[model samples]
Target chain A: MIIAFTSKGTDWDSKMDPRFGRTDYILFYNEDTQELSHLDNREVADQAHGVGPKTAQKLFERGAQVLITGNGPGGNAAEALKQMELKIFVGAGEMTVREAYEAYQRGQLAQGA
Target chain B: MKLAIASGKGGTGKTTLAVNLALYAAATRRVALLDLDVEEPNSGIFLKGKLKREKQLFRAVPEWKKEACILCGKCSELCRFNAVLKLGKHILVMPELCHSCYACSELCPENALPMTQKSLGFLRHYEQDGLDFVESKMEIGVEMATPLIEQTLAYAEAEIAGADLQIRDCPPGTSCSVINATRDADFALLVTEPTPFGLHDLSLAVETMRHLDKPIAVAVNRVGIGNDDVFRYCEAEGIPVWASFPHDRRVAELYSRGETLYDKVDSIRTGMDAIHTQISSLGGGK
Candidate 1:
């Protein structure tokens, strides 16, 4: 599965434009499946700076089985990911994208669980 | 009349000007103050008002039906925000990532997309010293302050539409939230200190206000601290300098203690009075 990491809250990718201090979109692609998804740090809630709801959608599209970040799955973002059946792991701090993917590969993460 | 006090950079006395203006306006007219600085709203700290009402703000996100799903990936492809994802038999929606533009649901031929509301922040109203105050605080971990700022402004509009005047304490930077705050104002008070950062951001703020076609005036706080770059810009642009406050240690100390400038400096009281008069004349109000 292909997964992407976006700096936006939880919106679709087509809705965002590239602007200064608002361009936090990261995508992780699963080459085998050609799927893509994304993630955004909870810090985005402070101002909606570059974070939107599309980050979650891109992550799911890229086949992100698990999401690890500073925010839990109880807010608006969690509900969106819940609909996608993606696991949410909150308080995942300072870990690189590779570290997060490895944790997901080990089946060690779930939605706020 | 509604006046928005805005600055492009933070810590440039936007709150200071807003609070003093609100306090000064309230002395003669029924005034309302709306703080659109959701990130770090300092107007409340200065005003020291008692909370009277509070409400949560929310945004909607689409939900997908997994039971009758064909996993055709049509919804994902049609979504501009990339908020929809299809993997194997699973379809996912990320609410925080959703802008609620409804593109996914509208384009979905399968009719699998449904929308649900998610809380984004809190809108609080308070009253102190005959001034009504409205403030918004975005919930931690939820992005997208535009919706909350929009909702908060709507609430303020409903409550203060008939008032004689309203003061909006706008957020820093020329972002969407700041646009939302100042879009409907009769005039904007662009507050800035006389520093390099102040001048650079002031130019950006002026550009934004001009783009929105809003009439603007400049208020130079900490006037004697820095050079005359702001003055030169205003002179060249022909933007009126509404007022100026010298860099007084007592005024700064009062501000540090959460007091309005008018409360500390008696001369500012006269300055604010003149500003209100000038605004009234411009707005055709007595």
Candidate 2:
């Protein structure tokens, strides 16, 4: 499964960005390959509307099956992600991407409402 | 000819000029006064003695059919407002976020989506003493008024076809709602006071009107209350000063009591007559 984490930087040591739609970077980690890749999220920051759903579409297109972020998705974004069968886990709380992924592996992260 | 009474700053007497001009012009010409300030429509206050006809207005949102279910996500991808989304085992449609463009229903391949009407506001019509009036009253806490204002103009076009003059009392500030109200106007009369703040906002409103490429004029209200900055700005910009009214306690008191002072006050009548002459010079003689 590919886990997507909203991050403040490209590396795993960067803090988790609380914003789901307008986060600086999204770190994608593949569990099988143990490889990490990041995508810049600056494009959706200045949108006047529909930033959340657009961000969700980015993740859905990247084949991310799971999302770990500081907060849950908004109503529209949550609906879109849920339709794509993407599981979302919260409770990162300023942790780095690696720490959040490890916590998810340990089953310590709560499912986002 | 269509005339729009607008103001950059709030409480600059846009309604005062609009109601009085409608009353004055209705004496000799066929006039339809449209109150486009949906958020706070007060033109009906002064014209309340007339009999009014009211009608509800609605915007077309999208409705989905559950049985024709194909989770294609085409509607979601097409919608720019994010009003449509597919959730777990279902499609979610939020009507409030819908812009009512009908693109979703038109693009649905399965033909499962249909246009649904959602209540936007009310249109109140009044005809008393030869003046035809209509006001757009938006529902409380509703943010968008452009649709309602545009609907009001359409209603005016259909209901008052032979009218010689159409006067719109636009809301203050040069936002999208104001653009929607004044875009169809033949001439825009910007109402302002003689203050620095009034001049500042007047310049902004002028820039907006310039972008719309409409002929601009100025109406200075409560002339004695502030300095001559508004007049100076209008002169510098070469926009005509159509009329000016003095700051009188009696006029303010009459306005407070939902009365128009055009008939009772001589100076006010003269000012309105000057405005009428300017409006008539637009080449449509009545």
Candidate 3:
């Protein structure tokens, strides 16, 4: 499973970003390989419209099955992510990427908060 | 000549100036007053008359032919607006998100997507006090005002043949919609107040007009409230100061009751006429 965390920076030590669609960076952790990756989301952050749905599509394309962020997806973005069968969990802004993943593993992270 | 009345800040009295100018210009010329502030069109409030005609604006959306779709997700990839998305087994099309760019249908390999019309808003026409008034009203929750403004302008252009003046009351802010209003305008009347916030937005709007490279003038509304910073800046920029309206209690009282200040106030009416004469000297007169 590929779990994605919206982050303010590119590293695992960076705190989670509050914005889902306009987050600065997305940190992806692969449970199978125990590897981590990062994607810059700066392009969509500056868009005048459709940032939510466009970011959701980009996540789906990157094989993200779970999204952990401070805020939930927007209306159109939530619909698109739901249609892709991707799970969304909220309340991760204060946590680092590694802490968020550990919390997700323990089932302590909130869902759509 | 087409004159677009715009301001970077809201509540700078674009509609107030526009309606008054149209009313004043109608004395000797056929004037078309288009209220392009689709989000909150209030020109009709000032000018009351029987509705002459109304037309709904429509834009194309993609309709998929399920039998012919190959499930390749090519259409989704081609849509820049994210209006189309490819689910696991099918494609999801959000009609509201569509920009009617037709990229999905144009790029579909199987020709499964077809263009269909969707209602964007309404174009309303009213004949009020000898002026042809046209206003675009975007449907509730719809954000596509530029296209409807374009359509309304086209319709107004066709209807008002050999019109001596066309005044577009543009939406506030220097956004894409403002650009849509000022694209082909021969002149722009930038309405602003004398406050700091008003001058800040006025500078931004002036920059936008300079980029458009049209003749721009300034109208200072509610002149007594703030300092003369706006005038200094306009003078430094070499933009003409067309007219100024003093801040008066009676003007506010009249505006609250939907009354024309120009009709009741002699000074304002004369100021509006002076602005018209300036426009005429600038060769905007037809």
Q: Which prediction has the highest TM-score against the true structure?
A: 3
What are the runs in model 2 whose C-alpha is more than 4 Å off? A1-8, A12-21, A24-39, A56-113, B284-286
Chain A only TM-scores, each candidate in turn: 0.47, 0.94, 0.92
For model 3, residues B1-286, the per-residue Cα lDDT tens digits are 8999999999999999999889888887788899999888998888986689989898788997889999999888777777888765668788878888888998898889999887878888888657899998999978678788788888987887767889999999999899989999999999999999999999999999999997899999998998999999999999998999998889888889898877789778988998889877877665
Position B87, candidate 3: lDDT: 66
lDDT of each: 0.72, 0.87, 0.86
Per-candidate chain B TM: 0.94, 0.95, 0.96
Which 10 consecutive positions of candidate 3 chain B have the poorest summed lDDT?
B81-90
The candidate, 2 or 3, that scores higher on DockQ is 3
Give the TM-score of candidate 2 (chain A). 0.94
List model 2 lDDT by residue over B58-169, tens digit each: 8888898988868888887788887776653467776767788888899999877799787888998989788899998999756679889999999999988878999999
Off by over 4 Å in 1: A1-113, B106-111, B284-286
Candidate 1: residue B223 lDDT (0-100): 81
- Candidate 3: which stretches are off by over 4 Å? A8-11, A32-48, A61-63, A105-108
TM-score of chain B of 3: 0.96
Give the range of the ten consecutive residues with the poorest summed lDDT in model 2 chain B.
B85-94
> What CA RMSD would candidate 3 show?
2.2
By TM-score, the candidates rank as 3, 2, 1
- Measured against the native two-chain assembly using Cα atoms, what DockQ does each of the candidate structures obtain, in the order listed? 0.18, 0.28, 0.52
